[model samples]
Target: MSVTLKLATSLDGRIATAAGQSKWITGERSRAAVHQLRAEHDAVLVGAETALADDPELTVRLPGYAGRQPARVVLDSRQRLPTTAKLVQTAREIPTYLVATEAPQARLTDAGVRVLQAPALGEDRPELKAVLEALAREGLRRLFVEGGGQVAASFLRCGLVDAVEWFRAPIVIGGEGRPAIGALAVAGLADAPHFRRTEVRELGDDLWERYERI
Candidate 1:
């Protein structure tokens, strides 16, 4: 399965301010474009931080396309998702999958959500490649990762990212702000992951770029 990592940042590559303020970083056109990208994928995944911070629906919000919403997946190893979250509340409408380890499968299913058990990474995150392979076995052909940084970095560091659709707004957020892609502890430049720029376009006042793994 092909994986696309998508994120919008400021001109200086900040996804959010130093205080974690991230709403409306880009223009309306760019946000709408993201919904269109979500509709094209089989499943859209994000890390627990994004889920906690945004409480996002992660569904295709485009008009008249509600039924085509892809599966919503979250990498929440501890199963900390609250039932009040939009994804959990509307689990019946759109398929919501929680990737966790040894979670209460019965309880989650009772709430109309599916659970995928996997091995943990670091303190409380699932291994990305295993999660991807599990999704592939379930017949998911395309996975889109709409991020909150650390997840994006994990995928990129593991060489699991097939492409990136990065959007840069005209405004600049200083270095104190949170970066678009989180840190990867590469010892040198040669060890760092690289991608070949494939396309660039202006979406409203934002710069939208596409890149493929070199």
Candidate 2:
């Protein structure tokens, strides 16, 4: 299965303010384009922090998109996913999955969410490779990993990301802002991950850069 990681951030590489206020970082065009991207993938995934903070519906919202929406998946390693989350509430209507390392949450399972158990990574986080294998077994061949920084970093660090779609807004979020990607250990310049730019387009005041692994 191929995994594509997508994120929208400021010119300073910050995805949110210090307080986690991330709404409206990119314009309407970028938001609409994200829906299109979601439509092209077999599943849309987010980390537990994103599920809790954003409460995203993770469904195609475009007009005349009556086709089947992609499955929604969450990497909640500890099974802390709330039963009242929108993903859980609408699981029966649209397929929703919770990948965890610990025991399944009964309330969420009773609410029609597919709870998956997998191997743990560093600090009890769900390993991305196992999650991808689980997803692929269910026929989710193309994955769209929409993020909170830690999730993206995990996949990239594991060398599981096949491509990246990063949208950069014009403005800069200075002063203690949250970075788009978390810490990556590197001793020298050769340790950085490199990508070949495939395409670049303007989305309102934002610039969307698409890159493939090199």
Candidate 3:
């Protein structure tokens, strides 16, 4: 499966403030572009922290556009996603999946979520490659990974990310702010994951940058 990681951050690469308030980092145009990106993909995914923190719908919300809403997927190794979340509430209408290392939860399953069990890593997290394969088995070929740092870092660290769609706002948040990506423990320049910039353009006040894995 082809995985594209999306990032909406401040100029200094921060996704949120020091207190973790991340709403409206990018302008309206950038968000609309993100919805368009979601519509182009087969499924949209985010980590458990993102699900619990933001409680996003993960749906394509373009005006007057009537198309298939991309399947919503969450990397919740322990099945932490609440059934009250918007994604769960409207799951019967839109395909919703939860990837976990544990057995499927009945509450979520009854709420119309399909849980895919994956092998666990050393930290008890679902193995990335296994998760992708499971998702592929369900016919999700194009995966859009919208993140909250750890999720982005996981895909990058596993060399699973095929492309990146990054949106950067003009505002600056210093070191105290939350980073857009977590630490990869790159000890040398050669060990770092590299990407070739494919495109760059302005999306309102935010700059949208696209890159392909190198």
Candidate 4:
């Protein structure tokens, strides 16, 4: 299975402002490109915190695009994803899966969400290896990770990320803003995860950088 992490952030690598506002980080063209990327992947995955904060539909919304929508998967270890969330509301129409350490919640299951269990790791987070295996069994081999920092870091830390599609805006959000990636516990430069830049181009005011794990 291959995992691609998508990041649409400011030039300073900030995904959002200090107040947690993240809408429209990139321009129209970049956003449209993301929709295309969604169509290419088998499933789009995010952490529970991102699902709670953004309430994203994770659907491909290109103009007049009638292709099969990718499945939406959320890493919600404690079953924290709300039943009222958009993913849950449209779970029956678009395959939505919730990976958690706990048993399936009645509300979520009744809402038509498929719950998968995975072993917990640090801070009770779902283990990445098992999560990927479970997803692979469901025939979701091409995974797209749309994140909110911690999720991106988790995949990098576990060496699960195969490629990266980074969209960088012209503006900078500065140090006070939220980072695009969280702590990876790299004690030295050599310990950091490295990726070889494969492509770079401009999409409107944003720069799309593609990288493969080296």
What are the lDDT scores of the predictions, listed in order? Answer: 0.88, 0.91, 0.94, 0.95
Scanning candidate 4 in windows of ten residues, the lowest lDDT window is 76-85
In candidate 4, the residue pairs with backbone N, CA or C atoms under 3 Å apart (3 or more residues apart, or in different chains) clash, namely none
Q: Write the per-residue lDDT of candidate 4 for residues 1-214, one digit (tens) a residue.
A: 9999999999999999999988888999999999999999999999999999989999999989999999999999999888789999999999999999988899999999999999999899999999999999999999999997999999999999999999999998899999999999999999999999999999987899999999
Which parts of model 4 are misplaced by more than 4 Å? Answer: none
TM-score of each: 0.95, 0.97, 0.98, 0.99
Q: Candidate 3 on 140-202: residue-level lDDT in tens?
A: 999999997999998999999999999999999899999999999899999999999999999
How accurate locally is residue 20 in candidate 1, as Cα lDDT from 0 to 100? 92
Q: Between which residue pairs do clashes occur in model 2?
A: none
Candidate 4 TM-score, true structure as reference: 0.99
Candidate 3 Cα outliers beyond 4 Å, as residue runs:
none
Of candidate 1, the 10-residue stretch with the lowest lDDT total is 101-110
Residue-pair clashes per candidate: 0, 0, 0, 0
lDDT score for residue 47 of model 2:
94
lDDT of 1 at 45: 94
Give the least accurate 10-residue stretch of model 2, judged by summed lDDT. Answer: 183-192
lDDT of 2 at 82: 80
